[model samples]
Target: MRICIVAQTFAPQEEGGAEIVARMCARELARHHEVFVLSLGMSGDRLAPTGEATGEDGTRVVRVNWHNSYLPGHKKPLVGRIEKARWHLKASVGAVSAKEIREIFAREQVDLVYAHNSARMQPALFEASRQLNIPLCVHLHDYALLCPKSSMFSAGGNCDTPCLKCRVLTSRLKSDGEGMTAIAVSEALKQTYLRAGVLTKADWHVLRNENLREDKLHRPFVGRDSARSDIFTFGYLGALSEEKGIEDLIRAFVDMPNRRSAKLIIAGRGREDYVRHLQSIADGAPVTFMGFTPPEEVYGVADAVILPSRWREPQSLILIEAAAYGVPIIATNLGGTPEIVEDMKTGWCYDPSVAGSLAGVMEKALKIGHGNWWAERDKLFPGIRGFKGTAEASRYYERLNALLVEAQRPDHLHLQAL
Candidate 1:
């Protein structure tokens, strides 16, 4: 099948986990089927190039430039917010030409359009697919359909209900339309959308994000060794945003006993103000900020990793990656995290809401000792197979395409008409 993987951003310009997952899925799909990526380009120029280029993985990528008067990449406080809002508004109304997409679909003879992180590209492509009689499947990586912020996290907790602004933004979001299928990275995320009345009319499936390739998993496990090293190292790798609980992680680390002997390494980038605030709180503590360390380097050195997310993290790829590296995890007991990290068996889970809860968990983790950590690793490493590779994930996409094709059959339509 000739598949067009649509996303807001692709690799070399990735902002988060969604892009990584999309690239991996696209490359795996390309092994068997022809794959094309439609994404936005990151440039402030008015007439930046908007055309096709071969991705690093050999897949063809078509980058579309957002040519709105409202600067798409502007970062000024009030003006930037307004520009982003205008861009999203324009995108929702199909400002990006449907004719252009139709022409591309025809030229490529695209069999299916698999959308991942289409917040920037908007629902225009979805409508175009419907008009062209092309089957479209959307993979939900975040809550962009229900919340403009996309994390469904605000102030300090998961959003239980949409606010007035959220309702307005959600109203502007285009519907999935008839015959569209929705794939959620986790069952928790699926239920969240279902309860919010988002994607209610579409078929739903849960496909966990792939964490590591089989070849990458061949490295020797790095279990904690308390005897070899006097200081225990705890690491946090990902975006340094507030919703990610980086502040909380720092606070918990500072409060841990014998923190002088233990070290906290934070490796990611976010708002400088937040980073400064974290630094202020971490003063006098053994904390090191590596800015942005690659995942391989992070897992290689850290004794354990912490995912102190305050929101309902829909299948954290870091948790699986850390586990795959034989490094234990200490994560919040929210959303799909528990599904990945079994408390006490694989890693520890703490309540993100309760004060000192994460610190308590961290203390427990520090006491696990090298011997116990290895024992847990021995048990959990075998189960890591399910989350390791993209081969199975690609097969899921293939199955989805077959199901969609069958649903579009003339006889199937006739049966449904009865």
Candidate 2:
């Protein structure tokens, strides 16, 4: 199958988990099938015009320069905001990316197009697939369809319903997601959309994200050092945004009675103001702000990982990564996290909404100690075995592609007509 993977950002851009997953899936699919990537070349303040490049894995990548109304090159914050608003307005009518995607389909004879995170490129790509009579599979990495914020998180918790601003802003866009097959990273995400009356007619599937490379499966499990029994290391890895409940985590850590013996390590980048706020809250607490540490290093040092997200995390990839490293997790009981972390068996889940819920969980984890944590790790090892690589995930995509092809066959159409 000649599959064209579409995403707003790809490797070297590294905006979030969706881009990483897109790159990994493209590379894995390239090994057995003809694969191509179509991504925007705009990263941060850099904007590269439309061009062709080869992925590290030898997959062909077509980088289309999205000349949306958003003047990404502008340095002024107000100017950038205005341009972004203009671009969103224009995108709602039809994404400027449609023409480029149509050209790629014609040039490459793409059999199917798999799109992820339709932030900059939405209705346009969907329209292109429909016009070309090619199957388009959309992967819901976030709640962009229902809410423009993408995270569906604002004012400390998940939005109960699409707000007036969201409805008005996205009014022109046809997000009904018709004529596209849908795949969500977690069951919780799928249910969220279903409950919101989005993608009602689309066939949906739940495919979890892949975290660990296949080679790492055999790597020896490095349990927490027995010598370090004097102190427990608790870690938080991912964006340091307010929506991630980073403040709550820090508050919890500071309030713990074992604050001096227990250490908190926060690894990831976020807004400067937010980072400073977190630092202020951590004053006198045994917390280290290791900005943007690699996943390997984050997993290597921590005795346990915490994901204190206030929103329904589509799927906390960190949970899977932590499990792979034989580290137990302490996450909030929200979204798809519980699906990954089997409460008590794999890790503990606490309510982030409650004032001291996360702190209580942290205290419990420290009491359980490292020895028992490692034993629980052994029990949860099988659950995380699925995170080894993208082989199984690639197969799911291949099967979906084949079924789409079969559905489009002449005989199938004739049977439907009969």
Candidate 3:
């Protein structure tokens, strides 16, 4: 199988969860099959002088600049429906050019196109998948395919509201015409393309979950757990967006009765204004904004990991990463979170909607103490064999291969009509 993995960002550009997954998957696939990555470079960055290089794992990578011009100078507020509508419009146009993509498709002769977040960064890929008659595997990193905001979080930081607006509405209105619109259109186009039978004949919809690697279950914190007794640590790793509940995490930590010894370590960067706001909210609590550390390090130092996501996380890699390290999790009970953490088993879950839920959960988790956590770790953790990365990766490929076989079958046409 010759697979071309497509994503808006990739290694050497950004260290996002999606990028990490794509790189690992592509490299692993390359061991058995021919895998080439087709990724977009940052707008202003040209190819490095050395050009393409083989990854340590024998995977080939090719980076192309696909940043949209609308991305720059388009960042603004979405106050009303009309403004939100217009913002989605220009975003849809600039993410990727169909003409440029077609040329790449013709040249690559890709057997399968695995697209991550193409709804925004590469709409042209959807069109190209149709034009080239290539089997397209769409990976849903989040709810971006179904909701404009991608978090499935309602406006004004609420989540109870049912999904109403599609990215198409935003795209059609040309409200802001930025990365946001490109994002919405990706979802809108995904729904449209699926329902309209545009890519119904394609290979698969690859929705990635957290890195459920259970092999590292015994890998505990490097230092003596008892030695760090005086210090209490809470971990939150992900983009520091307003919708991510960074604000709430700050508030909860401040509200915590154990605020004296406890410290909050936030990793990842986004929205400087929001970060500043969170800092102000911190007041005098121990909050450290590390701004995106490696996944290993982020999980290494934490006594317990906190995923205070206000929005529904399709799945949280942080939760999976922490679990793999046997770190107790304290996350919002939303989206695919339940799929990962069994309440009071692997870790604790709290409602993001409630004010003191996070604070309460944290206080209780702190009481459990790290030394005593191992006895309950197995109860919380998934089966070691099932959760191993090798097993998980194999399942992903099996599903993907099955989709390809299904696409080539004659009965698919009848099913397509229905």
Candidate 4:
């Protein structure tokens, strides 16, 4: 089957968690099925409007000219809800003709259209998928559909209480003006586009179980059995933006015991000023600015990890990777972080609401015995799929194939497997 994987951006164009997911999934899917990625072009990279590139040595990549909301050279494209909304508005918003995408689909002869957050969160791509008569599968990368910030985090920067007056929800209410009209419209969009209709009804909704079967590295994980030592390393991987709880983590680290020896490593890119501010807060307290190392190396250097996200992180790759490497984690117990890192098991969860919760957790982690570390590490086996290679991702392709077969032959019902 020929698969068209659509996303907001792609590898060698822009490097991020979402891009990495697309890259890994495309590579895995290509091994068993013909996989082609249709992605937005990054700034400064010159090429034709749409053309092919390779993911792995063998996998294919196709870049498309979709509008980037950020100005040509500006950083921090996705700073907040408004910026993201504007970005989404720019991408397919009044820019790319749906007729063009439809023509591409027709020419490419795609069997399935699997979009990540791009089509799932943005209304324009949703419209294009419909116009193209393509069976769409939108993987829920984050809470973009539910919350504009995609963190499900409101003002004050925390995710503890279930949000009711979310900006997106409240903004719609303000526009529609009271009564049943706004409520009705919101429900219709959720039902029609989000839940059971536009996003899922096209085919399958792929949600990954923690681990994959292909990588034999799954069991007997490397770097996990290492003993904790005096030069304690505390690190944060992934986006270092404000919503990611970087400030809070630093504040907690400031309050931590014996901070002179402990090393704080912050990886990944975000606001320059904010990152510099964090570095200053460190105040020469043994913090290293290892900006955005390769994934394998990031896991290699980590003694323990910190995922003190002030927002609702849909699923943290950092937490999963930390657990996989047997590096204990100290993350805010919000969103899917808890689902990945079991408190006091794989790692500890700090009170994201309070100031010292993260710092206290770090102190406790330092106290944990070496034997207990191995025991906690082994407990991650079931949730280890998140770090496994494309085998678990292949299940997504299988699910997509099943849904399409069922759609094409509703009456046949033989339960097709890909």
Evaluation by TM-score, superior candidate among 2 and 3? 2
State the displacement of the C-alpha of residue 292, model 4, in Å, after optimal TM-score superposition: 2.3
lDDT of 4 by residue, 300-400 (tens): 65667788787666666666566656576778877666655663266667777775777877776556533454455545434432343244443655654
Better of 2 and 4 by lDDT: 2
RMSD of each: 4.3, 4.4, 6.9, 6.9
Better of 3 and 4 by lDDT: 3
1 against 3, candidate with superior TM-score:
1
Runs with alpha carbons beyond 4 Å of true place in candidate 4: 42-56, 67-94, 120-124, 146-149, 158-206, 209-223, 228-230, 343-345, 369-418
Point out where model 2 deviates above 4 Å.
Answer: 42-47, 69-84, 95-97, 172-179, 216-230, 375-418
For model 4, what is the error of residue 221's alpha carbon versus the real structure, in angstroms, after optimal superposition?
7.3
lDDT of 4: 0.56
TM-score of each: 0.86, 0.86, 0.73, 0.73
- Sum up the clashes in candidate 1: 0
lDDT of 1 by residue, 1-418 (tens): 7889997666656357787778877876777778899876535532224687786668788876654553222132345767767866665454566667778888999888888888555656766787888877788888888777787888777887677777776675657445777778887888888888777877677766753455555355433222233467788998888888999989888888867767888899877888899999999999999997777667777777899988888888887677656677888988888876773245778887788998887777667654565555556444443333333433555554455454445343311210
Per-residue CA lDDT of model 2 for 1-418, tens digit only, reads 7888887776555457777777777776676668888876543434434588775668777777666543221122444777767766765565456777788898999877888765567667776888899877787888877666677787776787788777666665445665567778888888988887787766667777754454644354433322233467898899888888888899989999977768988999887888998999999888999998777676776788899888888887786667656677888888888887763255778877677888888888777665665555555444444333233434555554454454434343211110
**Superposed model 3: Cα runs more than 4 Å off:** 41-67, 70-88, 121-123, 146-149, 158-165, 169-230, 369-371, 374-418
- What is candidate 2's CA lDDT for residue 243? 85
lDDT of 3 by residue, 332-382 (tens): 887666555663255677887676988998887667655554444455443
